[model samples]
Target chain A: MTSGYKDLSITVEFRGGAELLFEKKKNELNLPGDEEWTLRRLLFWIRDNLLKDRPELFLLGDTVRPGILVLVNDEDWELLGQGEYKLKPRDTVLFISTLHGG
Target chain B: MCSVNDAEFETDDELMQPDEVPQTEGAICKKCNENNAEVVLRVKDTYCSTCFLAASTHKFRATIGKSKLVRPTDSILIGHSGKAGSTVLLHLIKAGMSEAVHKRLMYKTTVLYVDDGAVLGQTVDQRKSTISAIREQVHGLGFTGYAVSLNESLHSSEPKIYPLDEEAEDLKGDSDVVDLFNAVSSYTSKEELLHKLRQKLLISVARSLGCCKVFTADGATDLAITILSNIALGRGAQLPLDVGFVDSRELDIKILRPMRDFTRKELIYYLNFHKLETIQTPGLTTKKEPYTSIQKLTEKFVTELNTEFSGTVSAIFRTGEKLSIGNLEASNLIETCALCRAQLDTVFTNTSSLQATEFSKLISAEGPKGNIGKAAFELKKFPCVIDAAENVPLRDSKNCDNCSCSKGKEKFEMSAKNFEKYLCYGCRLIFKDLDKQHSIPDFLQNSVRQRISLDDMREEIADFLL
Candidate 1:
C-alpha cells in the first residue's frame, strides 16, 4: 500500500458543536492519492471544500484549533503522529470540540 | 573548542520538540496488557474499550463513594444541560444503578433541564424543540425529567414545572428575561446574571422536588476555568464552595460535582466508547468570540494551555482543592448575600480594600459645589448628616399623617443603594450593572425586606434587660 499512490477513501466526523462550523456531522470523501497524503494535507483540503463558515473556529495555522481533539479511528491522534500521520484507506477521523459549555 | 567563549554555541533543539508519539499499531492495553488498545489518553496512556469503560466507571463511582455524602434513600436531581459531560454522567449513573444484586446504587435519580433559550434569543418554536429533544434523551434513560423556563425567575409565585413527556404552554409574550438581558450593560455582566439566575432556579426546583442533593457535571477543566474567572470577578471569598465537590451555599440543599475528576476529553472518549450521542446546546457565548466575556476568555486560555501542557488543568484544580473555608467560625452565623446566597463579604477592617474603594469614590465623585476640599470634609461627616436627614423625613411623615409620605410607614421599598448593602462585594458589582434594582427576582427582594424588618425590630429592643 505504501509503494505507489492510489485513491483513498475516508470518513470524517464532527461532534460537540464542532459540526456547527462544518454544517454537517459527518463526511465521506475520496482523496486522490497522487502523493502520500498526511493529516496536515487533509485538513487544508477539508477547509477548502467542506468547511462552511468560521474557518478560524476549526483551523489554527497548520493544525486543527487547540481546543479541538482529533482522533484517528477512535484513537487519539497524539498517539499516532498528530498531523504528520500518513493517511491510509478507510481511515476514520473524528474532530470533537471541547470549547462548548457543559 | 579552543575556549568556552570561542566555541560555537550549540543548543539541543530536540528538547523543545513535542513529545514523541507512541506506536499504536499492535499495542496492548496498558491496564489489562492482553486486549488490543484502541484509545489513547493523556498523551501516551493507552487502553482497550473494556478497560477504558471499566476505569471510567470506577472513577465515577469512587468519586461519589469516597465522599460518603449520599444516603441510600436520598434523592439526587441531575442538572442535565444536554451536553457531553452531563450525558456521560447520566450514563454512568444508569450503569451503576443497574448493576447486579448488592452493587446497585439505591439512591433515586431525577433529571432537570432549565431552558435558557430566552436569554440566547431563541424563538418559542426553537425552545420547544430543544425541550423535546432533552425530554427524549432524559426519558430514554428511564429517569423522571422536568423542564422549566428561566424567565420564571421574574414571577412572584413559584415557577411552573412541566413533566418532560407532557407539553408545556408557551409563556405569553412575556419578554421579562429578554428585557433583563437587554438592560445589562456588558456581555460579562449578562453572563454573570444568567449564571446566578440559573443557580437560584436550580436550588428552588431541587427543594420543591424534595431532593437533598443536586448533581452537576462540571469537569476538571470547567472547574479550573471557574476558579480563575470567579477570582477575576471578585468572588475570591466564595471560591472554595463554588469549585468544591459539595456546594452547601443553600444551607439545606447541597450541589455536588461527581464528574469533577474527569476532563472534557475523557468524557468524550467515554461517550464514544459506549456509542452514546450527546445533544449540542447553545450557551450565552456559543457563537461569540472567546474574548467576549471573562468566563469565555478564561475557558479559552485554560483549554489552550492544557493542549500545550497537559497538566495545566489538573495543577489548577489541585490548587483549588487546597482552598477551604471550614475554619471560619462566623461562616454559619454571618448574614449571606441577597443575590447569590454566599456569605456576605461586605464587612471589612478599617484599613481594607472596601473602605479604600469607598474613600476613592467619595473623593472622585462630582462634589456638591464642585470643590474637592468641601467634598472631602462633607464625606468625613456625611454619615451623621445623612442619618439626621433621613430621620427628619420620618419624623415629618409621622406628624403629617395626611401627606403621601406617610405611605412609607406601611411598606418598605428597597432602593438600589439600600439593596446593594445586603449584597457581597461581587454581587454589588452585578447589582450596579443592572438598569433597575427592581428587576431582581422577587424572592431576593422579599428576603432583603424581611431581613431589614428583623434588623429594625432588634434595634427597637436594644435597651432591654440582658
Candidate 2:
C-alpha cells in the first residue's frame, strides 16, 4: 500500500466553543494508515484538512492552543501520553476550548 | 465557514511528540484505597473519580462556609456565565440545597446573566436570542433569573429594554458602547472597559434586586490570570479587592467568589462526572484574534504555563490571596470615584509629604527618557507652572483633574472641561484612551453631578459648619 493512502478512521469532536474553529462540532476523518499515526501527526492533519477560519484560535504553533484541552478515547490526553499517543483505528479524539468567554 | 483550501495555519513543528509520560504507575487513590487514582490534584492529593468529586464539593462548601460573607438571610445573586466552571458551581449549589444534603443553603438564589454578546458587535437579534436562551436555562435551574445587556450600564438612568428596537442603533444612544466598539485601539483599555462595565452593571442589578451579596464565578486559574494582568495594567493597588475571594469593595453589596479554590481541570472533570450541560457563551475574542487583548493574552499565558507546570496556578493564587489592603489608602474616602465608586486619591493635597513628592518628581523629570521631561520643559514657557511654591492661583496651577498629575495643563483651563473627574486611579486608566467625553456613560455622569451638588452644598455651608 502507498504510504499516503488513507487507512485509519477516527471520530473527532469539538465542544466548549472549540467547534467555532472546526465549523462543526463533530467530524469523521480517514487518517493515512500506511504508517504509525501519532497525535502530533493528527494535529498537522486536522490543521491541514479540518480547521477553517482563524486557525490561530485552535492551534498556536505545532500543538493546540494553550486554553484548548485535548482528550482521547474518554481519557485525558495527558494520561494517554498527550500528543505522542499513537492513534488507533476508531479512536475518538475531542478538543474542548477553555478560552471562550464565560 | 471557509473551505480547507483557505487554511491559513501551517504546522510549524510536525516532528514534536506528546510530552513524556511521567512515572504515575505506582500512585494510588489517597482518599479511597480501593480504586486506583486517575487524577492528581494540587497539594499532591491523588484521587479516584468518586473521591475527587466528593473532595471538590467539600472544598466548595468549605470555602463558602468558612467565609461568613454570605448569610442565610442575605439574598444572593450569582453572576453565572452558563459555562463549565459556572455550570459546576450552579450544580453544586443546587445539590447543596437538595433535601439529600446536610446544612442546606436555603437562601434565595438569583442568577444575573449580563449578556456581553454586544461586546463582539453581535446584532440586536443575536444578542436577544442568546439572552432569552440563557434566561430559559437560568429558569430551568429553578432560580430567579435577571438578564441585562452590558450596554445597559451606559444608559443606566433609564430602564433598558432587552432585544432593542430595530431603529435603536447601538444600545439606543450615543453611550460609551460605541466608544468601546471603536476603542479597540488598545487591548488593555478594551478589556478594562469590559470588566469595569460588567462590574458596574452587576452591582447596579444586585442593588435593584435587593440582593445583599453577589457571587462571581472566578476559579483559581482565572484569578491567577487576573492578578498578573492587573499588575501589568498598573492596578496593583486594587489587587486585594479585585482577586480576593471576598471583595468588600462596595460595603453594601459585597462580591464573593466561592469557586476560587478549584482549577479549570477540576471544574471540567466535575461537569463531566456529573453530566451537567453547559451553554457556550461567546466572549469578546470569540471571533477576533486571540492575542489582541491583555485579558486574552493573560489567559493564553496562564493556560500554557499550567500545562507544563501543574501547580503554577495555585501558587499564584495563594500569593495573590496573601496581598493585604493595609498599605492602601483609606477605603472609605468622601470623594470616591464616580464611575466604579472606589475611593479617590487626593491629587492636590497641601501636606509636606506632597511637597517632598513634588521634589522627587522634578528630579525624575530630568532623568534619561523621563515621561514628564518634555512636559516640564514646555510648561516653563506657557502660563503653566511646574513645581510652583505653595498658594499659587488655581488657574496657574498645573494640576489636571483628568489624571492625578501635577504636570499637565489645568483641564478646567483647556477645552476638555466635559471630561469627568473624581475617578479613581484605575478608572482613570480605563478612560485614558476614551477621549470622546460626550460618550461617557450616564451612570458616571449622574454620579459626577451628584457629587458636584453635594460639594456645592458643603462649600456653601463651610463657614457655618466650622
Candidate 3:
C-alpha cells in the first residue's frame, strides 16, 4: 500500500453556540491535500473529521445550515462567491450561528 | 420558470444561484453614485461600505426620530447582549450622538446586561467570567453598565436608584428555577416565562436607573418571528405591543426597538465592517430541542422561508405594523393585566359566554369519572330545588364559603381567586398550568393584592352610599 495524501492545514472557528457541536470553539484541521478544497468540500471534511455529534445542526445539503453565517477571512462567504470559494493554506474560516437566542 | 411547489424541491445549488442579478459587476453606489458598490441590499439598493454605513445610520436615526417615543432629554437604558445586532445599535447610537453628527442625540445612555446564564444552565464560574467580559466591554465603550441576574424577576426589590444585583448569592432561585426547569410542560410556556421575566427585569432596571426609555435591539426578522409565535401562543391581541416600534404599554418607561427596520444580515455586515467582537450567549437551545420550543421552531421556519421566498420577513413585519388595539380611553387603559401589564381587551365580558366557558371546564374535568357525587346527583334529580337555591339571595353574589355550591369538588379551580379578574386571557391560561400558587412572582402578586383591596374598598363605599 502506498500513502498518497498530505494534510491540508486550515483554522476552523465557531461562535454563537455552534462550538457545542465540536470539541472546542476553535480547531485546526489537517485535511487531505490530494484535491483542492472548496468551501463545500471543506464542510464535508469537517463533518468527517471534527463534527462530534448532531451533524444535521451544523450541515444541510453539503453546506452550513440556514441562519449560520460563513465568513472567509472576516468577509461574508456570499460576497466571496459562497461554497465555490477555494480553501487556501492557513486560511481562517468562521461559522457563526445566528439562530441561537440571547 | 418553475412553480412555487416545484421550486420547493429544487436542488440547493439551483436555489443558491442569484434569481435576478439586478446590478452589473462593480456597480456604482445607489446613494453617492460615484464610489464602487460593495454590497447589493434588498432587491436593488447597492452601496459602497462607507455609503452603506451612512445609510444604515440614517435609517436608525429616522426609525427612532419618527416614532416620537423617545425625548431628547430622556435617559435611555439599552438592553445590550453584546451580539451583532445590539453592537450595531450601540455603535449607531454613539455615532448619532457624536459631535461630528449634525442631529446629535442629547440623552444619557446606560447599558444593562441581564445575565441569563442561569437559564442557559451555565456554572457559577462560567457566569462570573461572562459578566466580567460584559463589564469590560461596557467599560471599554466608556459607558456605565449594570449586571443583574435573570432570576431577579422571581423576587425583585422595589425600583431603586442602583439597579445592579446587590447580593452576591446565586441569582438562580432554588425552587423556582427547578420548577421552571422541571415544568417541561410545553416549550411555549417556558419560553413565554423566560421572555416575560426578561422583560420584567429590563423594565425594573430601566425604572430603577431613572431611564425614561428602554431600547432593545430586535431587528425586523426577529420581530416577525415573534409576531407569528405570539399569535400561535394565543396572544394576537398583543401584536401591537409586542411587535411595534414603540411600545408605550408601559406608560412611564417606553420600550423602543430602533432597529426594527434593519435586518439581521445588515447588522452582521455592520459588525464585520466595524471589526466588532461579540460574545456568544447561550440560550435554552443549549439543552432543548428546536422543534419542542415554539420560538425555536418559528424562528427556523421564518428564517428558512426568508431564504427561498425573499422579502418574506419584511412583508410579515409590514403586516404586523398595521395592527392596532384601537383608541383606548383613559378609564379603559387603567384596567391593566396583572402579569404582562398590558391594557385588558375586555371584549369577552358577556355573561353567557363566561358561564358557557365555566360549564365546559367543569364537564371536561369531571369527564370519565362521573363523580358528580351524592349532592350533585341529588341536585340533578331535583331541578326545582336547584333553581330555588340559585335564587336564595342577599348574602352575596357568591355562595357561602363552606357551602356545597362554593366547594363543588368536581368544579375546575379558578387561578388564585380574585387574581384571575386582573389577568389577561393569555396570562390566565398560563397561570392555570402552574401548580404552585406561591411561586407567582412578587410584582404580579403585589399588584393583584392591591387591586383586590381597592376593589374591596370600592364595594364598601358603595354599600355605605346605599
Candidate 4:
C-alpha cells in the first residue's frame, strides 16, 4: 500500500478578523519544508515563504477528534483518519480557531 | 333580523346594567399574592422592592469584603462598559480589603463617575439612561456621581465633517473657520471629541486629587484597541497598558483593572449571580451613540471575536505577553526632533498611531542590498526598544478615524471622488462608484463589497483597521 501526501493548502481564521492562508507540500507524514518547524511557521509564512515552515503533520491510521482542530475541505480531518486515512495530493488543510462563544 | 337585534339588545342591556360593587377583592398582585407587591422580585420568591434591596445588601457586603471604602473619602471612577469590570473588581477589592476576614468592619466607600460624553452616547436621553442605571445600582450604596465633558463641543461652532449635510455653510466662510474647521475635523470625530473631553477630566482629577491609583475598567478587549490615536496629536501609544500608566506616573497614582481574565458572558453571569448588575445598561443610549462609531465597532469586534474564537484571544494575549510583542512605544527621552522637538509621541509621532512604528526598517524599497533582510528581521523581531527618534510609520494606513489606519489627510471632507482615487488599489475598487444609500464600515469591506453585496451598511462605513 502506498502512503504519502503533497500539495496541501492551510488556512487559519483569526478570531479578531482576517483569514490567513498558507500552502505546502508533504513527504510521507512530514512536511517537506523547513518552516514545518512550529505550527505557527505555516501561518507567519503563508504570504511570504512556504518552504520555511510548510508544515508536515502525521496521523495514526485511526484516531478521533485529534484535538488539534484541523479541517480538510471544511470537514474535520479526524473523521477521515479511521481507515484508508491519508490526504490526497491536491487536498487543502485548514486550522481554525475553536469558537465556542455565543 | 329585527327580532334578533331586539332580543340581543335587551340581553346586552341587562348584562351591562351596573352591578352594585361587591365587597372589594383587594387590588392585590396575583404573582406576589399581596396587594402591595406592585414591584416584586419574581426570581427570588417575589419579594417587594424593599426586601430585594435588603437581600442584595448582604451580597454587596459579602462581595465587597475588603474595599475598606470609607465614606466620602476615596473617589472611585466608573466607565460604563469598562466600569462594569471595575465595579466587579471594586467589589472583589472591597472583599480583599475587608477586616471581615478578621471579624470587623474595615472600610466605607465613595464612588466617582466620569462620563466620557461618548459621542456614540450623545443626547440627554441616552445619558440619562446610562446615568440612571449606574445610579439605581448604587442607590443608597453611598456613591458620588461626577459627570464631565457631559455635552461640551470642543468648538464653539460646528466643523466640517462626515455625513456632510450640516457643514456646507461652514465651508463658505472667510474666517480661519475653514482651516480651523478642517483641523478640528482632522483631529476629532464624534467619538474622539467626546473621549478627549472625558480624558482631560480624568487627567485633571489625577493631578488635582493626588490620586493613589485611578482605576479605569480597561480589559483585554481594550488592550487590543488602537493605542495610538491620530486625533490625539500624534500621542503614539496613548492608552498604555497598566504598566504604561505606571511608566507615565511619577506620583503615587495607579490605574488598575481587576477583571481582565473573564469574557463578557462570564462578567454578566458574575454580576447576575451576585445581584450586582451595573446600573448602566446598554442599548438605551443608541440614539446619541449610534452603531456606526469606532467604540461600537470595537465592542462588536471583541464580541464577535469572543463568539468566533473564544479562548484563542486570551491565549494570544498570553502569547504576546510572553513574546513581549505588544504595542510598546520606543521613545528617545534625550533625542530631539531635528525640525520640531515637543517630545515625539513616537519616533514618528507626527503621523497617526495606526502607522506601524517599526516600519522604517522593513522597507522592501530598493535601498542597500542587506537592508531588506534587516527590515524583515525588524518586522519579525520582538517589539523593539530602539532610538525613539528614528521610528518609521506604516504608509498603508490612510484614514485616521479607525485605529488600524494611518492618519492621512481628512479624505471624507474632500471630494468623494478624490478620496476614492487616493485609496489603496485594493481598497480603491471598494469605494468606486460609491452608493449614497449604503453606509460602509471600512476599506476592507468596501473592497469586499465591490466583489459582492455585504450586509446593508457595510458598503459606506468602515471600522478603521486598528
Candidate 5:
C-alpha cells in the first residue's frame, strides 16, 4: 500500500521545468513519502488554475504535505493541530510556492 | 432543453483573419465556431477568440451590473494579474469614467501589485525589468500603482539577522532600485524591519489614499469569495462609503470586483479577441510550493462542484442576490457586536446571496453572554483578510555599497545546501493514476499530428461549457 496517514492517502507527483518545482528541505521535516507533484499534471494544473505563485507547498518525495504556509478554507492547520490535522472531504487547497524571491 | 433552429453552415476555411484567430499551442482552434461547428477540424477545450469575448463580456457586465449600484467616485484597488484580468480592469476603468471624471477619479484608482522579489525565480534583474514595464502600464492607463509587497517577502528577510541561506545570490545589479532594496535589508530586529516596511506599503500608501469605496477586478473565482465573505460577515463587514483620500482605517476600504462575473477562461478569451497583449509570462509555469493535503482536497471539491453545476455555483456568495434578483441589495445593519461594545460595534453582516435553506440561520444567530460566547465573539475577527497597505523596504544591492541597509533593510541571501534530496518526477509517477499522470498514454504514442475533427471539437466545447 502507498504510504498514507491513518485513513487518508491520495497519490500525486511533481514536474520540473520552467519554474523551480524542486526545493531542498531539511531532513526529518514533518512529511510522508518523497515524490513531489508530477510533471505534466503540475504544469497543466498551473496553466489551468491561474494561481498566484508563492512557496505554496512541499513535495517531500513526490507526495503533497501541509508545510506550505498559506491556509486553505481559511483554517490554519497549525491552529487546527498541524500535520496531524484531518481533512474533511471538499476542503479546497491552494498551492503558492515558497521559493518566490530571496 | 430547448430545441434549436436550423444552424447555418460555413465551408470557408478562412472565417477569421489571422488576427482574429486565437492561438494556444499553435493550432487552428476556431473551426468549431457556431457557424462552422457542424464540420470537422475543431480543437478541444479551446474557444474561437470571438466566442470567448462575447461570453466573458456578457458575464462581466451582467455580474458587475447585477445590482447596477456602483457609483462614480468609488476608489478601487486593482489586483492586476498582468493578463486578461488587468485588461478588463483597465477597460472597465476606462469605460466607467470619462476624462473629466477620470481626473476626478485618478486618486480614486490605486493599483496593487505583489511582486515576489527573487523567490518567483525573478532575479533582482528580472524584478528590475518589471518596474519599468509596470511604469509603462501606469503611464498608459494614467493611474497610480502602489507596489504592494514582494508578496512572499515578509518573514523571509534580514539574512544577516539569520544566517544567510548559503545558496543566496549577492550579485547586485545597478539601478537606484538596488539602493532602496538594500536600505530595507539593513534592519536587525524583525519587528522593527516589519514596521518600516509597513510605512512604505501595507497601511500607508494606497489604502490610506481613499476615495469612497475600494474596488478590484477580482474576477469570477475571487468574486465568488467576495460574495461569500458578505454572507459570512453581513453588515458587521459593511465598509464605509465616504472614504476620504487619506484614511488609515484598513476596514474603511470597501472592495468591489467588476469582473467577478467572468471566469478566467472567459476573461482570457475576451482579452485575446480585443487584441490586448498582456505582460508576458516567459518561462515554464510551475509551482514552487507544492500543495498540501487540504489544498488538494479543497481544489478537488471546488472543481467537482463547478463542473457538475451550471448556475448557482457562486451561490454561497451571492445567495441573497440570486434570491432577490430584482430586489435592492439589503444589508442588515446590526448595531454592535452584542458581546463587544467595548470594541467598535462589529457587524455580523450577511450578503444578498444567502441561500434560503440556511438564510435565516446566518443572519440572526445570537450568542449567549457567557464566557464561551465572549470567546466566540472574539473569534469573529478571524477570517480572510488582506491588508490593503502592504510594504517592501528596498535596499541597495550589496554590490552597490552606497545603498542603505542600515535603515532597516537587512541583507538577505540563500546558499544552496546539499539537503536537496527532494523527490524527482520518476518517483512521483508510481503513486498517481494512469490518467492523472503527466506522461502520454501508450495508445497515443504513435498517433499522427493533424487538424482535430468536428465531433471532438463539440464535445470539448460542451464539456468546458459545463
Candidate 6:
C-alpha cells in the first residue's frame, strides 16, 4: 500500500472503554504519506483497519461519535479543528469514551 | 496567532456557540489571569492546571462541607467502580485527608468495590484481575478496602466482604444471580435490577461495617441521565431521593453523591492532569447498541445533547435539585417498597394512571364487562392505600389483637399479584419482567413477608379501632 511515499508514523490511544471496540488500548501505525491527511480521513482509516467491532460506536456520520472525546497531543480536538485538523507525523491522537458508567 | 488580532476577531456568532472551544493558544486563565490556560471547561471558561485543580478540590470540599452531614471521626465508605469519575473521587478524598491539619478532612474513609463481573459476563480470572487492580489502588491510597460480588445480594444474610489484602473466596450462589438477570425480559429491566441489587448490597455492607454514610461517584452527566430515566421508569415520586446530594432513603444509611457537580469532561481532565489511571469497568449496556435499553437510550440522548449544548446536563441536574416530595413523613421502612426501598408510590386516585392500568388489565383478563367494583375493592386492600387513608391512625404491631409474633410461622406463598402490591411504581415495572418460576432474592422476600405479617396484624385489630 505504501509504494510511492514515505511512511508517517503516529500513535493512537484509547481509554475509558473505547479500547473494547479496537481490541487493544494503544496502536502505532504508519500511514502512506502520498496524500494530505486529516482527522476525518484518520477516523475512517482507523474504522477500516483498527476497529474490530462496533464501528457505529467509534464513528457516527463522517466524524467520531459524540460521546467519544478526541484529543490531539493532549489538547481537546475541539480546540483543534476537530475533523478538519490535519494530522502530522508522530502526532499522538487519543479517543476517550465518556459513555462508560461510573 | 497574534493576540491583538485574536481579540478583534471575537464575534457574536463565536460567543453564541458555547459548545465550540475557541483557540486557547494565547488565552490567559480566567481565574488566575496569569498562566496560559490549558483547559477549556463549560465552553469558554478557561483555566490553567493549578487553578483548575484548586477549583475542583474546592468544589469537592465545599459540597461536603455545606451538607454538614459527615462528622469528624466518623467512618464513611466510598463506593469505587474503577471508572474515571470514581478514580478521581478516590484521589480527591485521599488528597483531602492528607491536607494541612486545619483544612484536612477528619472523617475516616474506607473503600468498597462491588464487582458485577458475573452479570457483565467476565471470566473468573478477569474478575479477579479487576478486583486485584482495585485493591492495589485502594491500598496505595492507604485506606481499608473491601470487595464483594454482585451475587452476594441474593443471600439473605449480609454480604460477605473480603479484605483486599486477603484472597477472596469463590462466591456461592453465583448461578442464582445469573438466573435472576436471565429471567429479566429486557435490557432496561436488567439494568434496573442490577442497580437495585448493587444498592441493597452497598447498604447491607455499610450497615455491617456500622458506617452511616456512603459516598458514590455519580457525576453531573450521570445524575442527569438518571433523572430522566427515573421519570421514564415511573419513579418520579422518588426523584428527590434518587438524585439528591444526600439520599436518606434507608434513614440510617445515607448515600452522598459529592461528584454531582462535576461533568465527565472535568473528571477526565482531572485524571489526565494528575496522571491517574482508571480501570475500564464494563457495565450491562457497555457494548450493546445505543437504543437497547431505556437507560442506554437516555444516556446517549443526554450525552449527545450535552455535546451540542454544553449546559444540557447541568440544567437537568439543577432542575432535579429543586424537586422535593412533600410527603416524606411516611419514609419509614414499612412505608417503603419491599424491593428498591423507595417510599411506596402504589397508592393512586380514582383517575390515576395506576387505575387506568388496572382497568386495562381487568378488561384484558375478564372481558370488557369485568366487575370494576371488585377490582376497586381489591385495590383498596393494599397496605399503601390503607396508609394513605385520611383520619386513620397509624397501625403498629403492638396495637394488634391476634398478633402472629408469638404464633408459629405460616408458609408464605409470594405470588406475582401479592408481590406487586409491595413494590413502588418503578419496581412494579421491573417485577413485571421477572420470570415466575424463579424466586426473588431472600432479602426482598423477607421484607415482603414482614410487611404482610404486619398487614395481617392490622386486619386482626380492625374491628376494635375507630
Give the winner by TM-score: 1
Task: Write the residue-wise lDDT of candidate 1 on B83-140 in tens digits.
Answer: 8899899988888888673477878888899888888888888888888888888877
What's the lDDT of the predicted structure labeled candidate 1? 0.81
RMSD of 4: 28.2
Tens-place lDDT digits, model 3, residues B1-466: 7556775757787554534534344467778999766665674566677888888888999998897767898899999887777778888887778898797988899888877676767778787777777766666655676777776676647532233333234443444554654554565676787777778888988887788889999999889999998887767778899899888878788889999988877887777778777777767765356687788889989878776566789999999999998665646326878778787753343343434455456567776776656434443334345334532331233323623252332232223545566877667767766666335666676676556446545655776774
lDDT on C-alpha atoms for all candidate structures: 0.81, 0.70, 0.72, 0.35, 0.35, 0.81
Per-residue lDDT tens digits for candidate 2, residues B187-275, read 57877888888888888788887888988888998899999988877666678888998877787899899999988878877876676
For residue B59, model 3's alpha carbon misses the true position, in angstroms, by: 1.4
Instruction: Give DockQ per model, in order.
Output: 0.52, 0.39, 0.42, 0.01, 0.02, 0.46
A best-first ranking of the candidates according to their TM-score comes to: 1, 6, 3, 2, 4, 5
* Cα lDDT tens digits for candidate 5, B112-144: 654434333467667656655665665566565
Better model by TM-score: candidate 5 vs candidate 6? 6
* Candidate 5, superposed: residue stretches over 4 Å from native: A1-102, B1-55, B58-69, B73-77, B81-83, B95-110, B116-123, B137-144, B148-204, B223-252, B280-297, B308-312, B315-466
Residue B353 in model 2: lDDT: 42
Instruction: Tell me the deviation in Å of residue B94 in model 4.
Output: 3.8
TM-score of chain B of 6: 0.86
Model 3 chain B weakest lDDT span, ten residues long: B406-415
DockQ of 1: 0.52
- Model 2 ranges off by over 4 Å: A1-7, A53-56, A60-62, A100-102, B1-21, B25-28, B36-46, B156-176, B287-291, B327-333, B346-420
lDDT of 3 at B205: 85
- Cα deviation at B157, candidate 5, in Å, is 20
Q: What's the true lDDT of residue B189 in model 1? A: 86
State the displacement of the C-alpha of residue B211, model 5, in Å, after optimal TM-score superposition: 2.6
TM-score for the A chain of candidate 5: 0.33
Number of the top-ranking candidate, with DockQ as the measure = 1
Error of 6 at B450 (Å): 1.2
Task: Write out the backbone clash pairs for model 1.
Answer: none
Q: Candidate 6's residue-wise lDDT over B331-385, tens digit each?
A: 3434789878888777766677877776667657876688867776676554465
Report residue B389 deviation for candidate 2 (angstroms).
14
Off by more than 4 A, model 4: A1-102, B1-83, B97-99, B102-110, B125-132, B140-142, B150-197, B225-252, B281-302, B320-345, B348-466
Each candidate: RMSD to true structure?
A: 4.8, 9.6, 6.8, 28.2, 25.1, 6.7
